[model samples]
Target chain A: MSELLSAEIQNCIEGPVVKYGYLSEQIDVVATPQSGLTSSTTGNRVMTDTISEAQNPKSFLLAIEALERGL
Target chain B: MILGLFVGESFAELSVAESTPSSRGTLREHQRWYLPKHGLKAYLQNWLTKTPHKPERVIVSSRFLYKLAGHRLGGSVAQIVTSGFENWSHFASLPANTRSTSLRQLNRCPSLSSQDLIFAVHERILSDGSIGKPLDLSEIGAIHEKLQVLGLKKVCLHFHNSNLNSIHQQQTRDFLVTLGYEIFEPPVVDAFPSLEPFTRWKTNTLSAAVSGTFEESMKEIFEGLSAQIKEEQIFFFDGDLRLHQGEPLYRLSSLFALEACLYSQLSKIMNTKMKSEKPLTFLHFGIEHFSYLTDEKTLTESPWGTLALGTQGCRDFSIQPSSLLDLHDDGSLVTKGNLSYEPGPIHLGRGHKPLVADLLIQETKWPEIIDLDEKQARTSLDRWVLLMQTWQRSVKKLRFLANLLSVCFEIK
Candidate 1:
């Protein structure tokens, strides 16, 4: 790693760390690209999953439709 | 009998319509139906007779029945139920054992907090008693501490805003690391991930041109460019243009002048290329974003959430024609209408008159018609241009590296 990146990482690690809720397992990798590619990919995947789930049988969409139809 | 009224698959066929004027008409039109005390119907044999175009079904769930009950019971009964009390006064007069059980039953019913409670109770009734309680901050800290003690190698710390710089956060990080936890800090990429470098370059160039006195700045920029690249060759100019510091009018005028300069330069380049043996080339330029700082006190309090700025500054400069005002300037801006008149020159900082005058300066050159010293102008332009070129090359490299990484990933 370059000296600049190394220094930045050190700063981040030694800097103030806010403790949130715990996770059961340790993360294997940490990817933080300077770009929005990862964020975009993750967002698209989530949206696709949500749409597919909504279209599935026994989904919330079905429940809402049944309620509307007085079923 | 009430259970029988609700029982069977056919019970779902019951259409409950509120006794509104529109629904009353529908009820009268569809004669073959039994209307309950709350104007509910057992069936509407030909409900679609009135509006054939709109075949919409209205479902009245159990919540409607609860609302109907509240309406019939009046305000006092509704208030008693909300206060977590038994509706009937006779319940208090019952035997001790009977009263105790009756009180327990009343308390077991969901408490009403708002009018929406009628509908909320339906969901509550359907759901199993397995709702999770919101986790407290103390509980979260304890869990994090436990994870650290377990010797977890990788952990993520998420916080909003300046909270990351707090002592508590620092202490937590230290505690985790001291316990042998390896906090995960992702590698940072050097270049902008979203916008193309050319877009960023053009924006910076335009911003610099409009940030100050146009002719002087441009002359300086071109002079600086003379050292690194020939004046005849196509080149890029880049520098920090602190455009927001001055008055809004001046800032806007600077932008207009820069636009005119760029258009002229682009036309010249295209004309030259047309005469030469070289293929046609295009120069793409755009500003991604721009921001300015203003005194917080200047913002007027708006009843409608949005804050307004007083138009007194613009009105003071109203001597200039309205045609000069930029698209951002509101033509219908109303003055605060204060009657007091001060002696000094009116504050034109808030107005578009400066911008209009500056735009005129682009063509007329009224103030200083003569251009700056060629050598001095060249020196300044050269430095800015070189800086811009260096940044552009760096951005290009970063883009290449990103593409290489993606290609490598594809191969893998």
Candidate 2:
């Protein structure tokens, strides 16, 4: 398994590098659990909704005040 | 070194899997959503999971595709001005034949045509007094056949507007039902009592204050806000809305609102005397485009107070918050979420100009200094234009990807 893995890495490194410039040559790839990746999509959705309210001048002022309260 | 080895092994496996006929066939179909000539899929499917009986393909209308390609609804009037047209009158006075000839010449130069300025102007005029054509029944049938071949027994069809009020949309929905495909209709919720009045008042008041017509932009913004307010109200009123309807009360609304609604509804179920025998599956459509749930630290720093409302409401309902969806922007999709990747902050790059310094320089004794200031201003303006163009292109690409992904998901 170790030999096979090393050969795979060697093959990848030997392939043509296109966009990443120098980093492509020096790149190290790692695999981790799926949970390691963090996503902010949910937070942004909420922010979009909250900001939508700010379209109104009254809501705009309130939004500013709300922001000042820091969350 | 071990990590790199593991990654290489994984990549090899991925390549083998992707090279399979099934994967290649799907890729071919997906490429239709992007520039056909490029043969690239509009969206990265890194985060997509194929589940049976769910939507496998989302077909966006040509109208949206035009917009994604940087053709605005009102044409490139703003762009025309930036390209040195003094005003609307100046653009209008240029003979149509001459303008067309010049546009054709400009098209020959790839750099000048990169923005699709000529196509936008032509499309605007052509689509005047008419909405762009809708997808026909034949197109829908073709997509259905493709999904059927892929062994998808049923697929969910979604339109951006759930009302299905448009003649074309209604006809499409009717045709799909005839073909025995289950249509996923987003639940209708009542708007908050204050929503309409508030939106109307704001629009009317702001229209007067602003110089040009603000109604168009403000109207769209208010309509969206009204829809969100309705979703929130439904979440507050209907505890069993998701379960009863077989869908979340709000699917495409704001992430914060969706989380709050889900948490509240789930809490009600948890606290009830009667227990549900089976686990409830909540469908969060188009959630991957939104921000992830706010972390405790970030929540406190957020300017939107409604975020707090969502957090507090969840707590009150005894719902423990969880990361519901992964954050995948267009750049992240391309990079595959590289740890070292940091998007350049477009907003922060806009530096402030000092009016006081400019005034002083203009009144100064040194004429050469004034010339220097003018040169600097011109340079800054050029830079600003370039940045704006880049930002607009990025935004259009991201929007296109998001729309494509939302329209279609794979069935595994």
Candidate 3:
């Protein structure tokens, strides 16, 4: 198969990130894997209990998933 | 770049995905508590200077408070003053039918006029004390001519205290219909005139207050203004419906505060070149409910300081840190093992980054309000930049600490 990881990883953690978990042919279920920056909207602002606070984390998850799926 | 003024909470309805009355109240509270400390206007101004694609002119409009705030942020960046008569007293207190010639003349003070700046403060005065009198076509004609003389391509009108009725003033909404001015309004607050409750202690300065009102008034004002002017000549910047709620709120971030300073510094780097290119456009990126919890650990270590006294997980995520809402066990924030820090990729969203262009619009009235030629404008800009730098330096340290904590948590 092609390389599972590439420069697109730069969108995440700034340094080396090694994935640890059992890799199946269909899905790569990994344990807690470390990447550059744990992408979260929390880094952007101190969200109160408002909808805006939840938005970043939700969107961040989607973004990470998209990147990982493509990779 | 033409400056576009989005006074008050103009874009909130569009920007925010959804909002409740209480949620909106929290938003306004957050704005008052954090906006000026963030130095939003200065930040946007600096960004305008560095942006590769900028308008040659700018329109700086806002609520009365925003106008005052802009004045507080003096710079070569031009401003256009537009709003209702509530606080026009700050500029000039006049009776009905007083030709703006004198007011415009007053704006000509060396302290007021700057390079290529135009000032158009339109007040709707009816013969009686009621609202919605047709804009004296003569005044509209004069304002229109002034804009034309300045060679302005677009005008962003920050409609403050205008409500829906202000739109009918210019020949029953003729002026705005004709000029095609871009209109913007801030998010709506629960209370129409929030002034009643907080009479004792005003949370925001004049500039911040004005910005909010300006947003509300734009649509009606421009609708009226456009009706009287050339329709094709103007464009309204209502702002993205989804992002509007958060745009003003985002100004509170230490990152955004620092961005303003950086932009200003960058402007100095290219000051000579700035004149040759088109005028710079300042885009204000406001975020909604900037206060939120990442994980419990991250919530404690954030730069936003204590919002209330409670474990974040137990409290409502929508609550802002103000007297109105009591989400905490005590009035203070709990810091035991607090782990909040700079928004990580996980926090910010994987690929969710803000776009610069879509959030900005062209305006052409900034130069006049700042009185570019005078030392006061420059002085004000300097002070604003200085304050932002200080805040940035402070947040930068917090970011470092937060990152360290994030690493520690990851290992654990």
Candidate 4:
């Protein structure tokens, strides 16, 4: 894992920053167009999944569509 | 040459004119690009590369598109909350039997952002609104670099007692601004200037959730346009095509309000019975679907509850705020898996789908344009009518059965 991501999870410890909740993290990092999706932060207890690099995040496209529905 | 780059939900058009509108004609050549099944950024880059025009002046009539798509096309707003309260948004809406008054029905919704996307920043503002613990800038810098690599540049920040002190959020905002992140500063509602911390955070969070994606998309577009066309004076259109200065807006709820205010008068919204069904995305035709990943919860998924922004935001669309003929396709038509549905130029009639507003930006078309597939339109309407009829019949039957059961179960 790169130092950048590690720093975030490292700071996410027992304090005012890290909340008391389930710690299930899944970050679909678009490493590159060709690299598709990689487990960039999976080792830091974060799971990584590969998705189509070309399309917007599934939910984002939906959100826009929903907001602009009709007009 | 004067150039017009018109962007819409599903199509983009670049029109160039060698002279003024009154002299001969303003449109020498025009080309429309349809969004292929993937990579909007790639598609836009390809579109710009293929356009063989060098524009000295450019006018953009995006209006509503930018506000709705505030983040990168597919990017989400990375949410940051002060420590220990990450789940405040995640679980704030459940009926509080602790309210001490009464309870009502509500949807068990997800927060604007998913847990994975939300990060915790170390900062604390005391109940008395004092800076109890100063913000940790190092942590923010690390997060910035991490997000930079992933091409995510928007942040929705909330700190403890932000409304009271607002110092931590302000400092964090200033820091993120320096780092080039499009921070959606939780707004101060015009009516409620001294808004409580929770209210302010909620307002800002909703805005970020909705408009964050377009931030990246517009940035890419601006960069793409600059690399392609060296136009110095560029003007962007507002909700009603009114030219405005400044960057794209992050407050989608306000933009929607403007659209509703202007177009609602013309739309047939009086018939509540007919408008109940949020007009099923015109049978999902021309709807863009990005449902490859399902498990990850999106901003539109839960906490905000399907296009609602609480008391401060636009009322839920279910109230039929706008036209009855609304074709807003909110992921209702995601093709089961991925289909080979490709969109191309509308004039050539290359595709079967009917993505509207292809030629809308052109002044010649004014408020009317885009070729709708007659066959697709008919099929979609037929299907919708059939679905509604079936739904109405079922509802009537259910109501009758309920009435009968109520009477039978009465203590006579």
Candidate-wise lDDT, in order? 0.22, 0.22, 0.25, 0.39
Quote the positional error of residue B369 for candidate 3 in Å.
43
Ranking by DockQ: 3, 1, 2, 4
- Greater TM-score among 2 and 4 belongs to 4
lDDT of 4 by residue, B1-412 (tens): 5555545445555556554335422345555454433244565466667767565555554433322322222136677788898877554323222211110013222244566666798888888877778988898888887778777777888776776787778777898898788887665544445444454555456566556443555565566667565434554433333444335352344332222221222122222424642311110111221111111111222122333222211111110001012122331211111112233223224433322112111112211233445664455545544544554554443221111112111111
TM-scores vs. true structure, each candidate: 0.13, 0.20, 0.25, 0.41
List of chain A TM-scores, every candidate? 0.20, 0.21, 0.21, 0.23
Candidate 1 has an lDDT of: 0.22
Better of 1 and 3 by DockQ: 3
Q: Where does model 3 exceed 4 Å of error?
A: A1-71, B1-129, B132-134, B154-161, B168-174, B185-412
Model 2, TM vs. native: 0.20
Question: Using lDDT as the measure, which candidate wins?
Answer: 4
Candidate with maximal DockQ: 3
Q: What is the DockQ of candidate 1?
A: 0.02
Error of 1 at B107 (Å): 51
Deviation from native of the Cα of residue B288 in model 1, angstroms: 29
Off by over 4 Å in 2: A1-71, B1-131, B158-165, B186-412
Q: What digit string (tens of lDDT, one per residue) describes model 1 on residues B248-348?
A: 22322222222222222333334464564322111111110001111111211111111112210000111111112212122222222111111101111
Winner on lDDT between 2 and 4 is 4
